[model samples]
Target: MKPLPSLDVLKTFLVVDQKLNFTRAADTLNVTQGAVSRQIDGLEAHLGYALFARQARGLALTQQGALLVAPLQQAFAQIGEALAKGAAQSGTLRVKCPTCAMRWVLPRVICLQNERPEIVVEVTASVSHGVDFSGEQFDAAIVFGTPSLKGVSTHHLFDEVLTPVCAPELWKARRGKMPTPGDLAGKTLLHPTRDRRDWLRWLNAYGYEGLPSTKAQHFDTLDLAISSAMQGLGVTIGDLSLIEEDLGARRVIAPFSLCVPSGAAYYLVYPERPAPSPALQHFAQWIEGEARHTRTHLAAYTKPIHQPIN
Candidate 1:
């Protein structure tokens, strides 16, 4: 056996192989393009074969480079997993949560720390609604979609119930009356998704035939959109369960009584293989209990909206 190439060079090779461009790989690695070129050159020298074929357009991964990609990815993943397990032993559980669910998960995380000072829960909020356990190092994730995620044990939290919410003052302006479809005429609509799926679903479920032609603002996440609504910017659709505190505190009020199910629910998801850490187990049990409480409390709020308006 000969000598092994530097781990740094190998890592750089992987990045360049994935990107197929030194400038983009350097951008991702936060290094200069020249530095990335040097690392690839050194790695190819050590391997005694050309890893990338440079063309007029760009670089393509040679057969040899393609072969190294999967193994390197798996090796790095295993190393990361080992490091994460070592960190977990220190009594910390890292959890990934969608920004929209932060309203629901953050308070519970604080309460959990208060109740169980021995366990520390670190929550990372992201705009993405799903998590990729393969690439991500989180002990678990609070995913906000259907239970279609594979190879993970999913613990159902609660189904998302969508309804229009706005600042208390906005609702009060209507003389404490429940807002009808026509009330949305002049006000700007805040959309959580670019396609405005949430508002569309709620309107369709409420039996409104035409889409509102009012000015609209789109946000990357429901949390931002709801936050905008609380500032009296406009009305946005919100998940009834997640905004329970906002409703209770009168920060935001649901003007429409008909809250329809969006067919997606939040789930506590973790890998099925390599049994979960003890810290994960404890947090999972605690959150599952909290979710149960929420489901029971919001029972009336999430009732089916099929009945006709009086």
Candidate 2:
């Protein structure tokens, strides 16, 4: 069975049918005439009939459209009445993330929920890069890099800092000496297979022209790659923004005293329409606060870069 047209489409159909002019209908709806035409097209497609007849002057309703007009108008009136009678309901927010943020940001998000004790946030994480929200169902997403979607809104979360990090024991085995970047020849390189750009940039920045790309253990996510690094397994490129806890706890040591920006940044992205929901707004504010606190706390522990590791 065919689905009934939505209230918005029905409303548009009624307005255009009454005005007999696309321009007049658009003006009344405060939308472009193109929008009005599209809505009518959608409605007609849904009903599998032509809703408007092309006329020299303007639009004229087809027989099928005339039949649907009264019922659709009445249906929209009922929907509006119900809304006016306090039929609003709160909705759950579904969010997705990359593996890096899952470790730090996700836990902090739980704290945000506890602090407010009112909002609910459902989070999912993956090791993949560049998730397509267009096909997926999500109220918002905390993703790497800027949001490029046309209708999407973005909030800058934080910049990424990449540095070589390893377990304390691994560095201790180095005779308590900070090794140069070229010295990485002896250690295993735990690479985040998903992100290639930063790894290359890091190597190029330190002038490690001949640094042999030896594959030790490959991980798809920073969380896993860094975990392996912490196990004295290999050195991984750590996103400092996500690994502040590990760094502060001395679980990991930055061998090279220098770190560089990861080129891309984290962002809070959501569809922009009628403003954000209360839950989404609270989540956004909470993440913003968390990022601020993280940056501030990190500045206290910021160490100066030594002479080049090359």
Candidate 3:
């Protein structure tokens, strides 16, 4: 293979070719004249030909250099095209979602990828705290509850409702009798540390003064807590939308007829300034559609066990 000119040399050549003056090219490139001359020298050495004829007034392109100009211009144009394509493929669409919704959102993200394969989606799971969109690398986020940031566009995704869930065997052991909130007094309660307040809010909404506290196991991760609940370690408050697959597969059963509004909903947030990219718009539309489908699916299959608080 033939040796190639370095990008630095090519860039210097292009600038000097355009200006026809070494000083002007050096000024444009923010480099000293010495550096520019060295780059041109290296470029000419590699090609085994003088690119420019030194003149008293300025510099003139040699016959060989004139011949190379058109091809180098085309080469640079092709390089630009490749760079744009790479940016489209690798440009990140950063997103943040609640830990509980990660399971539901990740699977649906596969569908988004099918629709727009060029954009990469980066997801960060958190409990909706300390999200700094301006300081962080995120281009967009899907957060639960209200976004505290001002001057950003926010779209409501869906309301999350909590329901009591346990393994099917646990339900069978109880002889198919659904437990009320009071009935949970004697049973173990698997709790997500982030949603600890949810239990209290739910109990308060039910008009229950105080319920018996059983042996409680706290899990930092929603998936781990859900898995532990599915194994009949204890009953857990679950988002019906997230656990629909486990419910459908009979891995878990709702042993309570009571449910409570979680006082939180999902939101899609982005900067209000710079208009969104085509990729961001496409993803937002797809996610909203999927969320609607999830709601409809939940309504059709899962019975509402809890009434909304007034």
Candidate 4:
């Protein structure tokens, strides 16, 4: 425990590491580029190692700098989440979730807000997969996969099963004969740009390999792809958690008993801190309860029970 660098220096290092451009980091910190440079120099002298390397693109972390990134992120994330608690209504809570959750969770959040107007919660949307909570200023994130990120606490929301979903009219068009996974061969399939692998995985499970991969329509988000499915344009593989409302409303149905796990699951993510912050605790309890309701709906909808039971 020798003389360590201050929080300001560490924060500057993190921003520079995150952006890899001192100028951009300076703009974000509301400081001059020269000040940013000086901070880095002083920090480097304190630690007695070169923290960055000059490259054509920008500053790259040296081995020493690379080692510090995760720990530094954890330290700051804890501080930020703790402070965010005090900053909530007394200090506002900023939450980040991806598109699919945005559609499904917004109403629930509003309900939570209504119940507890005392807490101020702000929710923002992003592509949760591979998103860096460290730089996003998020007190928490509802991400599409398990918690692998360094600085955040992750909770299992639910594991996803990709179910082939299509409009009720499309199923009815088949005229009462139950549709099977093999039936997808003759129909258009919708693909979400981010999780297109689910389509291939499901196709392989059903042995529908001969269909041309490009035959499917692709959309940038899962919400868009499912919307296309609801219009009777085609069938899309849906994570039941995301499409629970549509399934319950009879807007879409899984045509077969077959459901394939996407090998990824939804997780509740927030920056790592020693103790639970007030805001984080409030949101976690509320969101986990919402997810439990969703899990039950997800389980019920993946079956073709909407069709006449045999």
Candidate 5:
């Protein structure tokens, strides 16, 4: 392949194309008119075509030069975009969050965007509960688990408070009576994990043996399982703090009133840099305040005396 002309010569051609006059183009490029002429001459020789025709009145673009103008302009515009995206001041904050936490994280993120219109927040939801910051391009992530991850700063959001929740229609199907631990015997049980670890933990804490394996439905993420339950598919163990809005709206009802605190919790995590980006810092502060508000909301729920489920 023939070597492309240098960026300097290509840029000179664009300036000349826009101004249509060598003197003005030279002035715009902060170069001498003779230098501009040499660049154009060199570019024409490389392409074996004259780009500009010297007219009695200024200059005119040859057919070949006109064709190159649009493509060159587009190429330069794309280069600018790539450079802006590589810089930290692009005004977009990319965040990764577990699918289960979207119920809690999504609304808060919308609120943050509304309050601070200057910053754009982009969220990626995944089934994985943790992130490898070294491999990902996210500015920050909301992680679910114990806050012991090394090389990252963590801000505790809320505990994984477990409780069985079902659609109001499902609960009302059994009449106005609230459900008990024994009521789960015949009802379909939704397991968030394939192994049913969350259900087992909560059941163990309540001193209640779990239901039969044949009556269970499994999902990859708690959010999916909870969504299915809200459709009256079954009763799923929900993290009470994350589902406060649903509980308040009566989309799902926690009839048992027994919230078991699993040892793990959700946290806002980011790499421990010497100086964090302003966008990350701003979001961290906002989310921490929101978390405090969530904790207050969860205070009313009855956390029965039970051993903490680890």
Candidate 6:
């Protein structure tokens, strides 16, 4: 078998051959003339043939050098093409999630992206009502609801438990009385406009027959809703997982012992038709693993409590 030339040597030879001057080639390559000369020398020794003829005028390619140029150029061209294709394939994976989910999931996603840099992620907050996955272009969506939509692949991420949260001052101001559905009649109710179903379901399950004409405040996003609650505007029912940080920080407090098991669950949904991209598949798997970790961690630290909404 013939001895293969080193890539560095071939690169140096190609540059020198094109420029027809060792000094110019060395300058272009940011290498010393002596280094370029040594590379040519090493290349010639390995090939057992002189590739360049040194002359008073400049460097000229010998017969062997001329013969090697075509194939070497072709090899480098192929390598460049492959690298370009690979870079194009390693694209960003767009993901959609609600603002509340983003607060919890973004950190996890950052860790995943760091580990798998080849897969870029673009997270967009979806504030619109319903799972409008079709309206937007996203590789995957993390939605809060049961897997009821047909023709979509849904992976149950987590079950949500709703707790009524209000500013700590609001709870204290209530004067030791746990607020009931009747008490909420005059008080402001900060509601998430994205999914009214959540509040409706809670109201139904609690046997609130007459819908109260209460002072209502609507927020287009969860963050806004939570912020409103924090400012002591009104009580907001929020997912336990999402508000765990707030509860720990004493930013918000559960005033009433009444809680509702939200029928909604977080699900990772993707199109059922075409096969998922490799990046999407990797992300889905990582999310499920993270969910498992969260379940285990929460189980150890927190005790499950059911608070019925009155």
lDDT for each of the candidates?
Answer: 0.83, 0.72, 0.73, 0.76, 0.82, 0.72
- Weakest ten-residue segment in model 1 by summed lDDT: 301-310
- Each model's backbone clash number: 0, 0, 1, 4, 0, 3
Name the better of 4 and 5 by TM-score: 4
Off by over 4 Å in 2: 1-91, 131-134, 173-178, 194-197, 212-215, 300-310
Cα lDDT of model 2 by residue, 1-310, tens digit: 7666665677778778879999998876767999998888877777778988989988888887789877765665455434323311445667888778887877787887778776777788865434434334566788886557656788887777777888988764368676677667777888877555556666776666644556566776778888898898978888888888888898998777667775678888876643577778778887888888888877643455322222
Model 5: how far is 295 from its true place, Å? 0.8
Residue by residue across 1-310, what tens digits does model 6's lDDT show?
A: 9868767778888889888998998776767999999999988888889999999999889998899988887776566445434433658777788777876688888998789888888888865323533324566788886556555788877777665678987754467565666766766778876456556655666667644545778877777888899999987877766665677788988755545666566888876645576777888999998887766644522344544433
Residue-wise C-alpha lDDT for candidate 5, range 7-126, written one tens digit per residue: 778888988987899999877566799999999999999999999899999999998889999988777655644543464577788889988999889998998889898878999998
lDDT of 6: 0.72
Using all chains and alpha carbons, the TM-scores for the candidates as numbered come to 0.75, 0.65, 0.63, 0.71, 0.69, 0.56
Sort order, lDDT high to low: 1, 5, 4, 3, 2, 6
Candidate 4, position 275, lDDT:
53
- On a 0 to 100 scale, what is the lDDT of residue 173 in model 2? 39
User: Could you give candidate 1's per-residue lDDT for residues 1-310 as a string of tens digits?
Assistant: 8788866787788778778999998875767999999998888887899999999988998998889999987886687668667767777888999889998999999998998898899999987677656556788999987757666899998888888899988754477565688888878899999998888888888878766756899998898999999999999999989988888788998766688877778999987755788878888999999999888877776655543221
- The candidate that achieves the highest lDDT relative to the unseen native structure: 1
Off by over 4 Å in 3: 1-89, 127-130, 173-178, 300-310
- Model 4 misplaced stretches (Cα beyond 4 Å): 1-86, 130-133, 173-176, 212-214, 302-310
- Model 2 TM-score on a 0 to 1 scale: 0.65
Q: Summarize candidate 4's per-residue lDDT along 234-268 as a digit string, tens digits.
A: 98888878877778788998777767776778888
Question: Candidate 2: deviation at residue 145, Å?
Answer: 1.8
User: If the candidates were sorted by their TM-score against the true structure, best first, what order would they fall in?
Assistant: 1, 4, 5, 2, 3, 6
**Model 3 per-residue lDDT at 124:** 84
For model 4 the TM-score comes to 0.71
lDDT of 3 by residue, 232-291 (tens): 898877877788778888899876555676667777887654556678777788888887
Instruction: Name the better of 1 and 5 by lDDT.
Output: 1
